[model samples]
Target: MYFIPNENLDPTLNLAMEQYILSGLNLDEEILFFFIDRPSIIVGRHQNTIDEINLDYVKAQDIQVVRRLSGGGSVYHDLGNLCFSFILPFPNQPVPDFSSFTEPVIRALRTMGVPAEKSGRNDILVEGAKISGNAYYHNKFGTVCHGTLLFNTDLTVLARALNPKPEKLSAKGVQSVRSRVTNLNGYLPGIKTTVEFRERLLSEIARDAKTIELSDADLANAEGIADERYRNPLWTFGTSPKYTLKRTRRFPIGEIELRIEVRDNIIRDVVFFGDFFTSQEIDPIVDALRGSELETGALTAALRSIDWKAWFPTIQEEDFAAFVAQGD
Candidate 1:
């Protein structure tokens, strides 16, 4: 991979750079940017900004919390973390499926002596612990999928960056989402520097990646886009779209069932109709499902995509959508 060596550490600025590349993907140009940065929290497109992040901790630390154009949970990025962005052509060609593009990172990890496997749909795990998690943004131009390689980063910062859903918290600190994840460096014995790991991974991905340096005009486009749109409060904390939702309690379709209600795009209520076991962590999944947009198809898409056993047990997509539609 060709390294661009970003001297810029501002997360939003780099994000604008990525968005610029996504909007302008040319037929012959596929660029890979290896940018470095300080610690910050990035929220996914459809997430509730207030519910998923700790503003006090982030602000106290001077960390940036920028919303990405993708759909998934928030993630932490820092100096010890490495972020890779791919700007591939999106033409008559179908935008690559989320899993298809993840292969490059999986392949790159193998080059680093880690037996990294794509697990639970969106995570890259080393010996069952996630080394990385990936999310995608689909724009009119094409798609951009980016996530963090934990390396030797600060897990404490990650812990602070993420705010556990209301149902997951007690009088104590966050009780869930704390144990399942592990830092990336826990897998590496001698590697003490994230920068070294970053360089190695960069070379692997850019082995054949074209080095199309961003021209002054290109950065200018990104700079303009950032200042006028991305950095604005209207697009930041003030621009969440609104929608009404409904749910059903203990309803059945074929052999599957759900007792669910939704409001503001979330599962406002839930009921178990069959032998299915939704997770102990079901509340967060419910929180994520709440305040969800009115896109019925995408709602069904997220439902169908999850590991039902991990959250909802034995749920059928068609049945769930039909149930939700019935609530309407």
Candidate 2:
């Protein structure tokens, strides 16, 4: 692991750095890098960005949003959170799996006196609280597994930034999302400052990196990729398709009537004309939903499979689906 303190801190440039290191690094040698960025919302590779972020809250705070090459739920990052990426060579396997790749970083955290462990499907937990979550991308050449360490992130800001409302499409750690989650500072209070946390982590992980610097060519290539896609809306929002649906359905506890739009067969825009405390951004699912084909069943059938009874126990999937499936 090597400390790559980035002077060029724009998220657009940083994402390009990750892409460059993952693709250009010498895979024969194991390399881990420590990265820090300004406030940004990173969306998963397959996730609908519109559904993940609270755009109004983000714009008001001047936070930048970037789509990563890997897939997972959206995560908020600031200098307070330390991000790490591991690029490993996949030899005979020719590709990386979730288990083998993430182990190194998990083990590293244990050395940091954090007692972090892998829990659920793809998360690293500290004392049953998730301190780090990760996702990956793999090719025949190698794999890049990157994740974040919430050492001392502004939790109140993170909560407001992530704002897990609507109770729909949050498949990862449904329980944690609906409840109170903590940052690492709660566990390691002494290292409360973000810079101190970053340095300590860098000192621990630096033992693994061969300590090579990026050449001018590498920086140029990274900047080129960032300019081409990282800065473009077409590569970002345009990647998601659009669809719409509308219906009226009711439940014993609550009810809804909605006209929705979907893209790429996923909920993109949703407008609830009925009574619900849903956030206004549900419009993305409704508006983008037009002409959208169900990945399975009409809106009602798909909704039934989701056990919202646990979270929004008062709401019924049928009513929500009716509103979702109505328009198209």
Candidate 3:
């Protein structure tokens, strides 16, 4: 196996690099890649971004939100987190075996005195508390099994940034996100920093592995890929599947209810019902939103373009836009 080093802190570029490596490279032996991203939220491919994250908090905290190629629940990443991926040739088996990929990491953790065990389908837990969440993507070229290791992650920000559905939390029998997760820091007695822990883990996984460094041309290509897809809002938010959103907010004037139907992240239909007084026709408001993209900026601009004061004189366009788009 060979190891590739990714020192970039940008999550979008990191994902782009992963794509470049997975599809662009012609590989014979397996490849191991590791990286750490600055504060960011990476959502699953099939998940609705509006439902998975606290949009207002994510925006206010200046956290980059990117959708990954794999399918899994959303996860928060910071400098304290370490991410690892293994790119291997397609196996001949009928089903993808996750244990084969996660066993090595679990063994490495156990060797380090951390009681790590594979939990459920794609999670690694320590003492029944989750420390790692994993997902994978397979293509004609190969399969990429990747996951996050919470070396010393910020549980506070993670809990605040992730907005898992109430049913999801209830099904897990956990009250809060922080209650179900733990950092590896408590288990490692001597490891002081995530960097040091990363090196230690790497040594255990591939001590004799060859190292591959990215060339300038490779980086430029990855950056182009990042610009084309990873950094594009269309790919990050617009790729969501068709869904209906019903949001009700109570203002001082009255109670407002909005039922929006979105397909491919574009609003297809919108219905407004409320006790609020209106001096103008409501058709224009619904028309303005029907074709708008279900994103913060797009929804806000669509609402601001119309004379909202003529409808709800007490409500602000920005606030209503946030409510409509974020579903918070």
Candidate 4:
């Protein structure tokens, strides 16, 4: 095992660095890196960015929001927070799981007198309150397990920055969007500061581990990746799989709430729920929309093929196509 020092503090660059290392690792190599982001919220790969965050609040705060390549819930990061990432080679078949990858963190915190344990799905809790949240991304080269450790994070900002929609949380079986989290700063009163805690954790993990440095080529590759993916809006916000696209149009009858699920450039399913009155059932129109492509041209063509006017007499086919083409 080897320790790689953190060279950048930008959330986008650090995420890109993680991807570069995880994808470029050799089969026999294992590396650990520690970093901190300057006030950011990282959304999971499969999460709906529009649902996970309050855009107005985020823009008002000027907090950086980036999407990670891993699958997990969104997390808030600040200068006071410390993040850890591990890239371990799995030469044999590796069943991607959280408990095994979180061992080092559990051990390190336990050594620091904090009773940290792997809690429900992907969190590390201390005395029933969470201190860490983790996620994983795997490739043939290696597996990367990265997570956030709230050492001395600002709870107020953490609360305000993350605005997960209540309905979406309930859909995931989460009771509340607010996390029952605690900071390591309060738990380790003996430790003077967050820097001391970081060093102590490093000491626990870096024992007998080689120290390595990122070469110029590695930095260049990471920078390229950051520019191409992390800093790009398409990747950060446009890649969310699950989003509720709602279109409300007032007709002579009543209002229509056209909610749809568009994923992988395909319209997977849609539900037209509203107080509008219809003589004929809208099941056929809804059935026709299933598995339809998301592009405006393709969708317009598909809608033209269907006689939707009979079901939604007041709403035109163009309006339906336009509504379907609303979101990213």
Best by TM-score: 3
**Decreasing TM-score order of the candidates:** 3, 4, 1, 2
Name the lDDT of candidate 1. Answer: 0.63
What is the TM-score (0 to 1) of candidate 3?
A: 0.73
Give every collision pair in model 4: none
Quantify how close model 2 is to the true structure by its C-alpha RMSD in Å: 9.4
Best by lDDT: 3
Whose TM-score is higher: candidate 1's or candidate 4's?
A: 4
Name the lDDT value of residue 93 in candidate 1: 55
**Which regions in candidate 2 have their CA more than 4 angstroms from the true location?**
1-7, 25-27, 89-94, 163-178, 206-208, 239-328
Regions of model 3 farther than 4 Å from truth: 91-95, 239-328
Q: Which lDDT value does model 3 have at 46?
A: 49
* Candidate 2 lDDT, 1-328, residue by residue in tens: 4434555667788888877776775546656766777988887654456756777998899988888776556788887788877776553454345566557666656676667777754678776666777777665456677888887777666767774435422434344442444577766667767677766766665655556778889899989989997888775554433325555443332234554465666665554432222212233344434344554346555455444443345665555444454432
State the lDDT of candidate 1 residue by residue for 144-249, as single tens digits. Answer: 6676787876787788778855443331233655554566666566567777777677777776654556788988888888787667765656533333432423
Q: Is candidate 2 or candidate 4 better by lDDT?
A: 4
lDDT of each model, Cα atoms only?
0.63, 0.63, 0.83, 0.75
Better of 2 and 4 by TM-score: 4
What does candidate 2 score on TM? 0.68
Q: What are the per-model C-alpha RMSD values against the true structure? A: 9.0, 9.4, 13.4, 11.6
